[model samples]
Target: MYADEICRMMVWSRGTAPATHDDAEHGSDPLTREWLVTNGLGGYASGTISGAVTRRFHGLLISALPAPLGRTMMLSDLSIRVVTPDGKVYQVGGQEPWLDETSAEVIDLAEFRLEAGLPVWRYEGAGMVFERRLLLPHGQNTVHVTYTLLEGAGPVRIELQPWVNFRPHEGALDRPVAGPYALTVVEDRYELASPSDLPPLRLQVQGARAEFRIESDRLRNVRYRIEQSRGYDAVGEFYSPGRFSLELPVSGSVTLVASTEAWETINALSTEEVQRAERKRRTRLLLAAAPEVRSGPPAELIFGADQFLITPAGRVEDAARARAGGDEVRTVIAGYHWFTDWGRDTMISLEGLTLVTGRHTEAGYILRTFAHYVKHGLIPNMFPEGKNDGLYHTADATLWFFHALDRYLTYTGDRETLRFILPTLTDIVEHHTRGTRFGIGVDPKDGLVRQGEEGYQLTWMDAKVGDYVVTPRRGKAVEINALWYNALRLMERWVRESEGDAASQRHGAAADRAKASFNQRFWSEEKGYLYDLIDGEQGTDDAFRPNQIFSISLPNPVLDPARWKGIVDQVKERLWTPVGLRSLAPGHPDYKPKYFGDLRARDLAYHQGTVWGWLMGPFVDAWLKVYPADLAGARSLLAGFPPHLDEACAGSISEIFDAEPPFTPRGCVAQAWSVAEVLRAYARTARSAG
Candidate 1:
């Protein structure tokens, strides 16, 4: 059975082809289908497969500042022109004129595929072949564009004009770039500085004779239709400091490297060499995290898991550890195309992204990294981009941290880690028992965690639009209490293992009380499942939601085993789709059908009825827990995500899907927990098959 799944998953090697456009509609919008490549430092190069920009985030060099601190869009596009020996000029790669318009297929695009996550575009026509490839080095901000000339394609000339920008990823530039760019043409290279402080961006043409035209021009009114629909500034302006025209030889390759400071080192290496080095580096890291490097289906998942692991800026303690020859700090970005290193995402993604992948060193670093930022016993809900301190609004990110760390210890038996984070764990328990941010505290009477505030969405179902807080699961949300009960149990076990007698006694008593209270209030004998939450904006929100899965799915199950099957059955009966579990059941009046339109429309559907891939992990966990004897059922559910890997973002899982029939992948194209949770569930399901 595993072999069959592995055989089916081999589609990742060929990847998905770019959808052809017969019209300018979104169904045929070239920019609607995108591809991305990241440097483990949180920097990435992403654009449509047709080489068009659809979002402000599209760019060739989105540099990871200092160490995944923030991202900046530097090189917007490299318009490529190819001249055949017969004097016929071919604009194989240009801005919207060539990227989107079907009339621009004069070059006759032959093929496009993601070879090892690298986007490759091939154009063949008029007895000439032009192939464009894009890759970002493992830990560098450089975007390498390689043009390989096939034999018999005739000797030709290739010109590259780079559109440069210096701005944040989310912003748009409507005016011309300010003066004093300090453009320079040196021996065999062209350099330009957007700012005085940032290193000069080096442009190198490998082995081709270069003619530099030192000039500047603004390409105005470059519109992003996707952003327009999202109700954002859709038009932008870009300035190119210069262009490079180079003479090429048949059967030869020329690479243009756009990078800061690394060009001096990378200029000597060919594009093939860089790709080979990157592949080797990625394989090493992937293997380090996942020792199970068998030629099977999970290999594709391991590849997906590697996308979220980034080398973040080391703190003072991390620098000290590095100086002492200890491991460097690392964290998981929540998703691609937008999200930063979120605390809730990192903690929830820990097991599958790190532990199951055999990344023990990174697991230790990630746990410690978040522990360093624990404020008042609450881990941050989100670590805002470009800053050190994080926002502490979550009622569950702190609790999720406990579950993540406990799983880490279970997988590695790292006693040293337990001892190290003991104080922080103790503080979390005490703070939650008393109170933390976002009105989060353990009720003294019931010992269950209660959290919620007017106008604040504290749980994972967080979606807000100005004054409207979507899914404001106010008090005693089902999943928060489940995580709360699990965290207490984890603390009790950690204390016992670490030989903290007094702490163990205290945590044990707390865990027992929380579980007793959880069972008493959460279960609904009439509904045959758990209540979604108590004391919602109204009274108790008995609306069927997948959140109840956690009561049985977690490593530390809080509900009685006798009632476990009922929760799983309810979720499977109503919320379960072929893709994932819906946030809300279908019969509810508030349940939304699809996630689309502007901010308000999207947010309304977000937690109301959108399907979440991450939820499947818990759903599967609950499935197996209730029916440990049902391996077929577990395997059947695990098969749901493989098709999704190819749908939106090749080789990665999407964050959420539409709730109605014909579920379409939506939200982030590559989400961390989406991929991680699916991988984690796959492992558990596979274990039962074994």
Candidate 2:
């Protein structure tokens, strides 16, 4: 969608400036305020709004290991000191937190907000305004920090310090680079090439005479409280290559472009130019998805969604292999900070992130990218992290693929893309009916999909540690059966829409049998809600959970309207929250309200009662279908998210929230489906409103 066209479609979605959190105005905590900017290659630069590198993931240049796999944190931080005309020195942001306990209290920034997708800062004091801007251009492993004294009392002197390191995001820096580490000192720029195989790190302050101290200093015991809370390494030391001192005249701007690419490409374009381009890209996104939404989606949600979709630039191994299959894989990284693209997440997020957003090209590319990975009538549960082979432990990621495809076909009307994957889709039906991975196959007793095993965690409720399967819903899971029924019906329509189908008669029959069996087996008159799982090892675990909502939410629902009212009321009364649905109801014994502690403890609560933001999409879908007129109530559910953007990741949604009151946000700071679903629901409401 072009910007002009987007403007026409988007009744709102106007401002390009990021929502602001000005310390001078509001005085928020330094550690609590964080910002994120990603290069479309799956690499990102993130830190707090106060400019302190709090998390190990906080870095200026965390390069995508190759393209989109194992990510490595290259540049740790930049320590900036500003000098006024009167020689008054001020910290650009905050220094290492433990350097001085009082430093955070003293460090005060003027203003901070996101401009387009980039992070921009303004230091307003001493009768002057010094602006700092960060831009991570799409598809490039580069970080650009442009400093311009927007308004100054007089000529000011600025001294820049860069704390650089090369470590895996999970690991922390140990010591300074060996003396033998390659260093190229020049008049305008300085480059550090570590002894390790990591990319060469370079810093170029364009239009300034670079002066480096060339001292290898260690800043130790920098505390990462967020990591510490998660039972991970919370403190580490960073090796400062050196500190550079330079002067900027009043109204003069100089950009420090750091990249893995050659020094020339780093300065190829101006940050303002990059900023303009990014804003246009964002505008198109809002506009393209405008038709999906009513007054268009909020700028925060629209911009937040842009962070997940990236070019499928995976780790490339050999030149021959690269040539055989180009690294031009377009995909949506499941979440920021830790998640890679998972099959289930990718399919569930497709329509909202791509089709609804008017990224038809990206949508088609993503579908085809997954299409290439289908095996034995199964799509991978997740593309192996940092590896080529994909895991196929999941029983439903393949089935969800059909619904995603059907959605794409409806939105795009792209016959060629659908035709290409038709055989793969048909093969999935055959494979599921017969048998596939785990114990997943159609049960002859009911014709409903039944899946389970000793250790395999097949459904999204999957949270395993060693041999312990957390939610081991190892039977006729309600949602999986719902998806299976939906898939069968989808295949029937897929055949009818694409090819005048004689070979696909089984789809309709299969759908009918699954629906009848689903209603018979899943329905519970005693409970007044559908069973969470039927015929499991434990024999019909009729727990109240949000999972059964999907059965009534899908386009071709297996549940009748009478059943829909019961399920809807049950979910609303037991599981529903403002942001999302709780994994388990409060009445359930296993339900844990808070998500915290070590891995095992956290896993126990992961699905037990955590409120999932993504589940809101299905909840909204089910609500609208059941009521068909409570648009106000449906809209109110999503209205809670706009404020959520201001709280956690700043204009993005968290993967999950605590089930208890004040429901603290947790998990991936920026989640794909969380953002996608809200946008989709907003659009659905907007269309209804219009």
Candidate 3:
């Protein structure tokens, strides 16, 4: 067999650089100082300053709608400004209207102009703003603006405002979604007299402070209270959806309370007790802890929270419906539904949404939705939500499906369900073996699968533009081969366990044959590291990339200990980042440090060199598995995760970061895989330790 013919290679020797370069770089001046703030719910605000030029900036991005009682209305207004070191004030809105793109239509919220001493910009709409001056010397000053919620006649009375602020310092910060202003909400209620029937109820508010209050005429005798904790803050007033003002400093907590008649009503049904029970239930459904971090309460949990705060009746069903919308809110709730969604996120999310969150039916529906589009043995690259077509080019989706199906079976244990999808699995394997997209067909010469083209993104380093694929590996990729190995193993297992047909025995034999062939052709003796891929010329480049991590990290290990250790050492030396693992080595010819240029430029650099937050999952998994004997070392390696988790958005993980030092969080504010992998890894390590 090919596996038996392959020879094991010795570990590569490590090199040491002079200590001068390290010490010299350590004393560089600080680049800039930026900080983040948020509302307890989901909105975020950040401030940044460029130390080089001393330019100050502030930005706010809102992610939720405001609700009064149980109704929400369109966002009406927003405003923001900054006080300069020279005592000159710069108003944010007066220059250009801030555009809100969180929804389909972009609303221009900046409208006010400066009429006096300072360049003050004001935006007036359904929301109110208050101006207050502060005393400071020429070197430093403070400017404050407040937003007041306005009342309107709408059936539903609640408004969820999404906000974020960024101050990049030297240059202008990214425009705030709306006006850069503090948000606030106040509630007012009144009743109308009736001759013989029930009285009418109403709720209203004013101000924009990322805060709201709630009051009800029906519960006039009751009062609601707000509480703050180490990392959170809130203030309550009355309108609907129970209004409240909240400030969540990173790494803090806050709680809401209802008093008097409202308390009595809530207490009558043991609403607090019910809420506690629900929280516990939801937490258990989404909880996944690794050696370092945990990510859960999943999309369904957030949806449940939305329903809890909005409508009490049919809340679970309402959450399901809301998730189906697939908008940014739904996307965020889902924690990073990639634009190109094959099964990577869809399958991983199942663990949280279906297996853990108790929404198995939704899990089945989403799987079926994707399975319906499988073509030529290939799962989709992603589904076009607005269209009816799928981009079928992914190698891992089908493989992931087997795993997801297995997980779903473990949770639901419904043989009929498993049998229903068995054909899909079989078709995928058959398609790959026969022939598929790119050159990803089985090669009889070596039994190793072949894939990719000059400018086509086949494997996951898939950053591509119009006819120009960056980081194209037109050969056999490391991870794809690992996935291939896994697929064969899964097929053999499935066939033996479920189908039990004689043909399955043939499939098992073929799988065993392929695995042996993979080891012989892919392992590099000279470099002591597995080649990332084998080119058409049969030459392998011994680059230290993350793809090889899967071979060892996965439940099925394909490489022997010597080869696995060599790859791990190489990866740790080159690809590891304090925040996460970089996509490409910093020393690569195409490496770029700056990632904030035009969209096309940034996208090209995205996977080619950017450090993805989700890669940490496999990296952590591989590290822990390889270093299983070093329990303390494994835990120590993950210690950066909790602080990184806490430092980024509150309880949320960023999508990607710059590969170089001062690795700033980039891409989406919250990512699904980042949370999923972290939570899953954390849970696995924690379970093992326990």
Candidate 4:
């Protein structure tokens, strides 16, 4: 997911098809679709089932109503039953169900029923109604749905219906097509359509609402039309594949009918099918392992409205929906709620967004935006929404910003832009020298920077609860010092090329001084590891942490080869997980595995022992930096990344993972940093292989 404050629509096509108006109207067709159906407008969809039981699958599901306007309706009644190709009947799973602000609550929803022989489940609701049957032959199965709406609304209109199409691409799967049709709003109307003719699309309307006769006809190729009474507004469009145009009256209600043609098609494709397809394609190219590595299948998930995207700046609306909703075709076009002046996301999102998918412009924006925050020697932790507020929690975001800037310069070679930010970079170093938030002041004795104790999180694993610091190192963190060392080196290098001999000499001396002091103070021979942090008293914590990864992995190296190898081995044995690099080692007294539950339990596990996606960047980099450059070894090390990239999520990536075994992808499913890190790692590996 590319992280940038500004977002725009991107369209890509193969061959020269002579750019035509048809692309604008229908968005370049056979009308492929990838729908990310969630119950709510914002939050993530839930698909987890705890404990075992039977009855029917019941939950609050949400899909965009098949209308012209882009509006969604709640699926209050959702029940499904499963039966194998054999004669055995599988128990349905739906218990006490309730719709909350962002998810469905199912109480005892998975009880095993004693009765057998082709089980079926019935679903009834106020606005919409349906029934699902289970246990049919394996190859193809028919699904039936009955729909009805309330009275006194207006004419009912259905437009651009869904259809299935085939793709000729090597790995292309079946695709859903959005037909061009329109519906009128009306009261008490019956509508129906089907993928096959085995059973006539069934419709029954009987209630207190006004009733209208229905006229249904198959017209113009595969298109179908249903017209009812006229009164309410009728608006809708089939946006692409998985999306439909839908609009509803402020006061009226509408019933939706849903069924798929093939069971395999249903299982193969999701509302986010297009986005998933794109993810598979990109992951294949990015994964260092096989040419065929793909994400896992789409998991059936649903979310509600009222959820918001959480960022350092503040919560923003539908920031990740494009990716979650399956609209992410290229670089998961993810948005942030706020982009503080320091541009926290800008630099951080680069590895995931640009390098992974090769979206460099997005990378540039991240650097430029944060450079905007370098005011008076401070690169803001974030830029507050609709204000000039710049929060400075991170002592190294600015330093990392310089590293990213250097990278951007290497990629684009825009020396003018590089020169433009040089002054700001100098200001940031100067500010750290003076002093800032927490107690991030310079230590004159050793020349190593001293960061004070603060409540806010600075580095990526920053977790704080109320007044207690979760993983506070107090004085100076290992990674921050590593970044500081890199920053000085970057400045020295930049000064030589852009500012000539005198500037380089001045910065070079400072870099040497800082480098010597950093090595002397942070290296720990007794522990055979770098100290996690150094406080005002210069006390060191020898805990196994990920912070030291940067001391060896980053582009600029401050640690000797022996120390780098030791740190890498220690981290690998302690914090490494298949899903990601853990925030802290499991053996730490504070480590906890249960990451889901109430706020405190979750937060306690957050940075204490959780695995983070972004940390994979430094881990991979450090591993390669320390090991002898064996192409086979590097490829073998990177092989684990592809499955996570292609599994079920399609083009999107998760935020964090469980620190322990079965490291289920948890936290946000489509995090900016995760995408950025994956992209950067993929690019690094790909370039090496090339």
Candidate 5:
């Protein structure tokens, strides 16, 4: 099963090293490259290839706690030290203190690679070779750290020092978890519990002899270098319960299971069995995808796409509500490290992550899950971390919901689910027709939906800092109206099917009015592109932003076909980059070539000129509309992404990048929509070209 896996192996070798020795390759620094492993309940383990904890979010275990607590980091790190028969001790992981000049250094990190979606590292020292692999068992809040003596003499003594912390994953370093932590041990198994309502962290060993030594202490001033560079509170303090000593012989192996789950769940499967099951599960995902995309970049994305589709375990109420309704609650986490499930990102990513991957049942579950949360004619803009209820402030996510449903119906021909949710859809359209929260409604004057309110960021360009909305886009946003027109057309068609044309006449007439108004009002005669927003707070915004691409990209394009070529060409000439379309054109006065610095600085440039990886999906759709025969050209536009899977976050895509050359990857390491849109676009092109 593993022999022909396209993205299964990524080796980083220092130089002309042996087949067993792997380090950074082609001057590509492994220190900057990161790897992630996720449990289907919104819990994950992530860190740099160099073994440095660059973010507070990096941990061996970040468990998802049911509502009001969210995700909590239970295990910060576990450093390994190897002592051979030759009486030599070497630090195998990395430096202890992030920036301590005198800290013991990692002697020889010979190699690093991803073997079957697992992060593996090899170290050679003391005439022996040691290899370590990390895995997070599916659907459980546990992480398995397995060690193998790939090449060695005999009888090597290994010391494992486990550091612990109890805090919200997004906790600040200033408020360190000063706790009276308790450590309980019962002959080979250990449990570390906090003073708060958080659950205990269980630790156990398998496949080797082990001993636990009680050495309670604190590792202070451990700096997260990446966070420091981002102008955040980078210094953190962690608690240590003790150390474990284990022995391994030639070709021997050992496994350490660290989890917050109960003992039964933790001991449910042996480490070997768990590994085999996970591998088989990933294989099934690849097989489910379209035949043309069963290998290469698309194959890797099949795994990447799976990382975002998770059960909302933290939102217990939502889960109960869903179960009562005979459905499961599945949603897409917007991105890794910080983002929760957002309505817009989920709907935008649904087709790529679920339908295209051929997990139609889970796809239906995700849509129905979001449907259960629809309120006030709006789907949730986002669910706040640690909270059960969602915040309904967006103007576009609900409309995108309609588009997602249309895609679902087109793919599965499932009329049953549509019939079930038709009332919800009808209610949404009615609310938009009259009005909803955040000043979102159809303007009778032009039949275009307008959205905005002081102190609110309604559109996806939404970036607010300290009560200041960066790109408020408080008006009839081009994409919003395009989505509006699309939604109206879909509603018209759907109502006609469910009922008759007489019953859908209102929706049909509304669609006609919106389409006419969209073409007339959005087209910029002099600029050769659509206006970013019409009837804005400060009048019309003629910004050359990528937002206008949606005018021709949706299933039901609002823009007239006569002007598509001009829009596509203008976008390609001014906003196009190999990685993605620039949010704002380079020549715009507000354009910032780089996205970096403190929160305010990053926010200002976020929607101004940052290159969004997800925008490539829309650009390809628009491009294909303009030049239907240029499938190769459309495929070439995505050439920059295949190599990118090895960067930022190994085997996944980034949220955004710098607008200029080098195009540094930024924002969340593994973004849901970034992987979704790329996979969606690549598969679409492959299907058309084939």
Candidate 6:
């Protein structure tokens, strides 16, 4: 049954065609459909299935370096060429220019699919077949690419040319770096060291004898079409130190190991051992999930969920501190191709990524870890890559922290962790009550939490371009107030449990006042739904957004119970899409159908009408709350994700999709909260179905 489900999750395609415009939205185009693998320490490898470098982030090794260095793109790419016994040359994987229609398809790629989150490709031509597989072992700054001659002529020579780069993962590809890249070879092991302060990148081959030829060359203007579309410097350059040539016999295989780790660490496991260990680890992860979600799309999402739960290796002190405390630092990488640990994303993703997956210890670790960073009642909005401290700019992340703690306790019953962070949690609530940074505080008269400040986008609808704050949901945003009310109630319950009734009464009273004010002030009597924001910069925003869903979706419903159906039904009619709920309703003046074009253009549409995949979690939660008997209907709402996993970042959910038809996936390819919410919702509905 597991094998059958694995086969089902596998997305495959035949032929070697350049990506068409439509292919970018769908998974059919190998050049646009990307795949990713991570090493648990924030290090990752990602590239398109067609093997072309479409984005600056497309690489074989993006090593997560210690403080100040962040994620460095060490090994950029590898050009693979196979020489047949008949002297026929074929390019299997290389820097193929996407726009070059004239480029010949030397390697006939017969198949490409992700086998249990590991990418596999098959090439067949002239009665010859070869298979390629790629994976990164857990918690190691390493990547292994193995090739096997499944059915090929004996003694066929294969050449490997590795491209080297010394830049941040988000660095401008076209920017030139001073590089006297010196190559040192000890037997088959090769190390490419640049003049930069960073460490050298190590490369080697296993299960095969290799010959190295010192042919130094620079490939210029390696165009990244995706970057160009996003209005950035698109062209890049790579330095190839040399080529490694090896001979492959029928049914013979060889593996290439690339890393920035020490030689001892690299040599700790053989290529097959690493592969076997990773496969077994993945299986164990799936088994750890709830029984109902151990197969099908949920099982595949369980794999996606693991990609974001990474150690903050860049913050070396965080690790040491955690170790000293007898705990490990675990945080969620909000999204791939470029996102660090975000407070909002992490808290939102906690239940689905950890609790449902049965990673209770890590869940506690995450909660406690964030608790260490709370400032003046606010959690850091995001920890910039390689930075020791996080930026405390968010208004609701801290509130979400309370909800995450509630979910963790509900799942594991680990009161010790609760007791440990309860003080910080109390401080957070007090801070919110009195008022904190970014003008965040509860209203004296109404008790509704209101947050807004100039030059800073506080809420989750935050999308800032230059001086402009898009969707600056300033005063008493629906979701923020809802989360605030929920947090107060949760605190009331926790305080009563730990410190007795007297301490808990304040929280209970505040929650009641907030709930009353929210129901009376925010609801649109004519529209029969909650307003997005009350007492905003302009006035009360009656813009029909999916944010109102949180009014009912949260653990504590802030909106009146009688109005739950009205809000849910309104969201269903206006904001809900197959993929997720749109940021804004279609008829709204700010509604933008598609999230595309340059940075400013995309950000404009970002919260205006873009469909956020993470919102699905809350939508589904609210759906089940409003329609408890229709578990099948809630399960069906998740049906879009299985097909979604096959596209964009294979085996993962994208950060956001287009609000319009086809809902072209935009923003980060693999999102943490996106995968988490979907997985959480799936598990809930599946259990209810049973």
Ten residues in a row with the worst lDDT in model 2? 7-16
Q: Who is ahead in TM-score, 2 or 4?
A: 2
Off by over 4 Å in 2: 1-28, 67-69, 95-107, 172-180, 292-297, 315-328, 498-501
Per-residue CA lDDT of candidate 4, range 1-690, in tens? Answer: 111111112122222132132111111111210112221122111221211111011112222111121111111122322222232222222321211112322212211110111112232222222222221111111222212223212333212122222111111111232222233333422223323222122222211132332232221122101000111111221121221223323233332233222333434433234234433433333342222111121110000000111122211222243235332211112321111123455566654444333445545544554565466565666643333355777766677787777777766787877776788887777778777666776777776776756575666556677877666666778888888888888888888887788887866776677778778888888888888887634477777778888888777887877677778888878887765788777777887774654455667899878888678777878877776465455545545555553331323456677777666555554456666565555545545632
Candidate 6 residue runs with Cα over 4 Å from true position: 1-5, 8-17, 21-27, 93-105
What lDDT score is found at residue 525 in candidate 5?
88
The TM-score-based order of candidates, best leading, equals 6, 5, 1, 2, 3, 4
What lDDT does each candidate get? Answer: 0.76, 0.75, 0.44, 0.45, 0.85, 0.85
- Tens digits of lDDT, candidate 6, 366-478: 98888888889888999898888899999989989989999998988889998999899889888888999899998898998899889899989889999999888888898
Per-residue C-alpha lDDT of model 2 across residues 202-257, encoded as one tens digit per residue: 77776666667777666767776666666676777767666677778888887777
Candidate 3 on 240-338: residue-level lDDT in tens?
Answer: 233333432212222222111222232333323433443454344334311122222223223221111111111233345545744111111323211
**Poorly placed runs, candidate 3 (over 4 Å):** 1-342, 348-362, 410-412, 453-455, 536-539, 646-648
Candidate 1, residues 1-690, lDDT tens digits: the string is 121122221111122343332211123223355677888888888877666777788889888775333687878888777767777677774336723323433554556665545567776666677777788877777889888777445578877788877777765555455446778776877777865345677778765777877667777788876677666777887788777888888777778888864555766567778878877765665556444433344566676777799886434555576447465668899998889888899999999998888888889988887777888998888866776567888888888998998889889989887888899988888888888777889888888888888788889999998988878888888889889888877877777877767858888898898888888888888878888898665888888998888988888889999998777887888899877899999979998988877788889899989999998888888888778888778768867676665566666788988887668778888899988888887777766432
Candidate number that wins on lDDT, 1 or 3: 1
Count of clashes, each model: 4, 5, 82, 74, 3, 0
TM-score of each: 0.92, 0.91, 0.58, 0.57, 0.96, 0.97
Error of 6 at 48 (Å): 0.4
Error of 1 at 24 (Å): 9.7
Best of the two (1, 5) by TM-score:
5
RMSD of each: 3.8, 5.0, 16.7, 17.4, 3.3, 2.1
Q: Which stretches of candidate 4 lie over 4 Å from their true place?
A: 1-342, 383-390, 536-538, 645-651
